[model samples]
Target: MSAGRAQAFWLRNLTAKIAAIPMILTSLVIFIGCSIWTVVYSFTSSRSLPVTDFVGFRQYERLFGAHRWSLAVENIAIYGVLTLVFALTVGFILAALLDQKIRFESIFRTIFLYPYAMSFIVTGVVWQWMFNPGLGIQHFVRQLGFENFTFDLISNRNTVIYAIAIAGIWQITGFAMVLMLAGLRAVDDQIWKASRVDGIPAWKTYVMIIIPMMRGVFVTSLVIIAAGIVKLYDLVVAMTNGGPGFASDVPAMYVYNWLFERANLGHAMAASTMMLLTVLIIMVPWFYMEYGRKNKN
Candidate 1:
């Protein structure tokens, strides 16, 4: 296109463009600018505040060597893996069930999605009480005459990570269900009719035909869930506070404590940079495959 035509096209949407300026500037300054600043300061030897005393990976070396950081990495890995698997599986199953044109489907969707409307902090607080031995499930079970029953996963260091995973799953699974349900509803009606005419079992058709057709939805849901797993912090704070001797600490919590509680600027930046790198590692390939391939085609 010529410059005149390009200018005309741009001017056609001038009002919309003007409306978007604030959001565009905010992304450029706050997101991209702060990210670059964080990466640059990660190499410094700053203690309480940012400084230019270059240390060249010294902070990262200390971050890796710290047992607390190592434990945090392990806890996050466990929590991420468990939450990713259960949330996707359970959410998809719920979506499939709801797609059957069941009774009061709208009410069921609302019931399932209500928890997701609540903030993570609220969900965490509610689950914390639900996990409490004296006040929650265990107490209720004991009241039913099962006095020897034990459901104190939150207090046990070894099982606290699982409790956090369960809470995270409960909060996000409904959102995943909504995504999957949209995908399911988008399936061509003729395809189902064809399957019925061919006498194909519904389960077999779903597994062998319908699932393969929803690749875009599955990929979108996968990325969203994985991103959540990477930056997990709020739920851990409200639920466990990295307690029971730091057994449930995650990378985000580690970075926060180092930055504020320990006053270690460089170290905290290094951890945060590492997190940013992990997210990039996961996202770059997906972006390449999803958008780059489309552009190429």
Candidate 2:
């Protein structure tokens, strides 16, 4: 390209670029800068104050060796897996059902999507009450006829993770359904018509044709849900408070407790760095496949 063309290229969309400068700078200073600062401090022996006394990997070693941290890791793993599986399955099913031209479709869609409008904290609190053995499902069931029924999953260490998963799924499934429904709506009418003409069953068409074509939608939903799983903290705080002896503890909560409660900044930063790496591990390849490859092509 000529010097003039290169100059023009640089000057292209100058106004829009100028408008975006604030946000661009904000991201650099906040996200990137803060991330680097945290990673650097993670190597130190910083307590309540930010210090420069480097301790190598002692903080990391301690973080991994801590029983609470280990339990948090295990809990998050189980919660993340179950949340992704059930959220995708239930959301897709609900989306498929809504795709059918049923009566009161708008009403059904609104009902399904309503839960997602509320904050996770609110959802957690509501579900917390519902899970209470004395006041929630157990009591309701006993009042009916099954007086022996016991639904105290939230208070049990082994079962508390499942309770957290339940609230997480309820709050998120609606968002997933909306995304899948949008993907379903984007499918061409001719594809369905052709499938019908070919005498292909609806379920078969969805499984073989529709789903395969909604790859972008599926990936988008997966990334969103995965990010939520990694940053899970507020719901656990509002619902279980890592209660029943730290049974429902997650990595985010662990980070918070170390940073604020215990005044162990270095320890918290180490854990936060680990969470960041974990998110990047899941996201880097996804970004490459979704956008990097497209740019290359």
Candidate 3:
């Protein structure tokens, strides 16, 4: 607390502040600069690498004309809905079972959740093989004298999107279960007593009373799931490669292909821009309702 010591402390902080400027600058240079660059490139008729000349809205015209683009948008909706429903249901059931004081809680939890920790590349590959017809679950089961064993959804045009959803659910449900179980565990023990005293059966109590009490947890889970829906890419790439005539193509894959593969920077940017807008349209209101309006009320 001497004057000399206080002066030294302020000097050290000042020097540290000066040192932090370069770090901040480096981050902004990468993040903000690249984002602006993407937006700029989106307005031009650049291919491969970005060019200076601009073509306003022409790229948007070509992008909308592409069947792949349209299919991708549709595929995202289907994948999002199927994954959300199945994952939430399976996760809830598993969580409830695990929460019932099972004999091997840790083991069961780990088994379910361990898949979520694996890289999507690995999950996509494993699932791709498992759903493949000749060398996977189908092969083994078909040999068991069930001659018409069919699990080739990965290659089927009508069902390829569901294959991606299956893989997604396998990887994501465990995490969702962990969330639901945590929410369920946090419910007041008094609620269980109240339900019992009111002559409510356990199943009815959970469905009618307890699950409703965990609305916040459910909303949070759904939001997380929704984000995954919007940015879906890697698994579809590894598993289906958007094959079987663009059956499982998604916005992320479309943007990536335009940006890198075909070098259609303008269209790529347009796709990316549209994606950003779509996410905003979907999420802004939910966020407003959940956080903004709640505060106002």
Full-model lDDT, candidate 2: 0.93
Output the better candidate (2/3) by TM-score. Answer: 2
Candidate 2 displacement at residue 112 in angstroms: 0.8
**lDDT string, candidate 1, 139-243, tens digits:** 999999999999999999999999999999998899899999999999999999999999999999999999999888888898999998988999989999998
Q: Relative to the unseen true structure, what is the C-alpha lDDT of residue 70 in candidate 1, on a scale of 0 to 100?
A: 90
Candidate 3's displacement at residue 234, Å, is: 1.7
Whole-model lDDT for model 1 versus the true structure? Answer: 0.92
Residue 168 displacement (Å), model 2: 1.0
> What C-alpha lDDT values do all the predictions have?
0.92, 0.93, 0.88
Taking every candidate in turn, the Cα RMSD to the unseen true structure, in Å, is 3.1, 2.9, 4.4
- Candidate order by TM-score, decreasing, is 2, 1, 3
In candidate 3 the C-alpha lDDT for residue 114 amounts to 97
State how far residue 42 of model 3 sits from its true place (Å). 2.3
Please identify which of the two predictions, 1 or 3, would achieve the higher lDDT against the true structure. 1
Q: How much RMSD separates candidate 2 from the native structure?
A: 2.9
Candidate 2, after superposition: displacement of residue 186 in Å?
Answer: 1.0
Write one digit per residue (lDDT tens) for candidate 2, span 1-297.
Answer: 699999999799999999999999889998899999999999999999999999999999998899999999999999999999989989999999999998998898898888889988998999999998998999999999998898899999899999989999988898999999999999999999999999999999999999999999999899989998999998999998999888888999999998999999999999999999999999998988888768988
Clash-forming residue pairs, model 3 = 48-263
- Rank list by lDDT: 2, 1, 3
